[model samples]
Target: MQKSLHITPDKCTGCLQCEMACSYENYQVFNTSLSRIKVFDFHHTGKKVPYTCTQCDEAWCLHACPVEAITMDKTNGVKVVSEDTCVGCKVCTIACPFGTVNYVQETGKVQKCDLCGGDPACATACPTGAITFIDSNWTGLDKMKQWAEKLSNQAHA
Candidate 1:
């Protein structure tokens, strides 16, 4: 049963708990700037969307790495970067369309979400249930259920 991070942007309160948790889990710090998962704030629309590596099947980062540093975790399909193998060329960063993969000056290596080795700290720390670890096959089911509930309510009214 492969699982993935399921984000509900509408439910995100912009509290940045996810960012803190991510940084703490990976870096032993509570800095948002060091966090792998970034929460994008759309102030005008009051929408806070947390974005990170989606662990694409055909990951550009993995393909762009010259040192063969990036590899897919077969267990959960997460793209993981090998710090020892990474040359810090930043080709993977440029190739990543979402800008999720990032370089760390301290380590001279790129980092991204590896789903916290199968139990995502961001999802665990989300206060509003905005970030969920769920079955990858049913990622869209929550949205479908939400729309169905709205339709049923409208019909009743």
Candidate 2:
């Protein structure tokens, strides 16, 4: 089954453990800038939202890559960028609607979330359970449940 990380922004505490873990796993460093996952801090709303590649079914990155560096891993449904195959082209970065795919000058290649080879370090490091590895088919389950609860409350009222 395909796996995905569900991030509940409301539960996030802005500790940045997820960013640190992602960077450490991929680069062996604690630099948030190097991390594929980024946490956006909304100071006005006092909120933090951890954002990363959504692993789109029809990934623009995969198609935009001229050298075929980006390909979909059928097993996990992740769009993985092969550094060796990449020609340092920034086409994929521009194709991504969410801007999750980014260019790395140090490596002269692009990077995005690879689901950590099916074991996401960011999800494991999240202290508040804001990030959870779950079945991709059920990604909308939480939102469905939340709406169901709200409907029930309205019925009672």
Top-TM-score candidate index: 2
User: Where in model 1 is the C-alpha error above 4 Å?
Assistant: 139-157
List model 2 lDDT by residue over 76-141, tens digit each: 899999998998889999999999999999989999999999999999999999999998888477
Candidate 1 C-alpha lDDT tens digits along 1-157: 8999989898999999999999999989999999999999897988899999999887999999999999987877889999989999999999999999999999999999999999999999999999999988984777799999999999999
Candidate 1 to truth, TM:
0.91
Q: Give TM-scores for every candidate, taking all chains together and pairing residue i with residue i.
A: 0.91, 0.93
The residue pairs in collision within model 2 are none
Clashes found in each candidate (C-alpha, N, C closer than 3 A): 0, 0
lDDT against the true structure, per candidate, is 0.94, 0.93
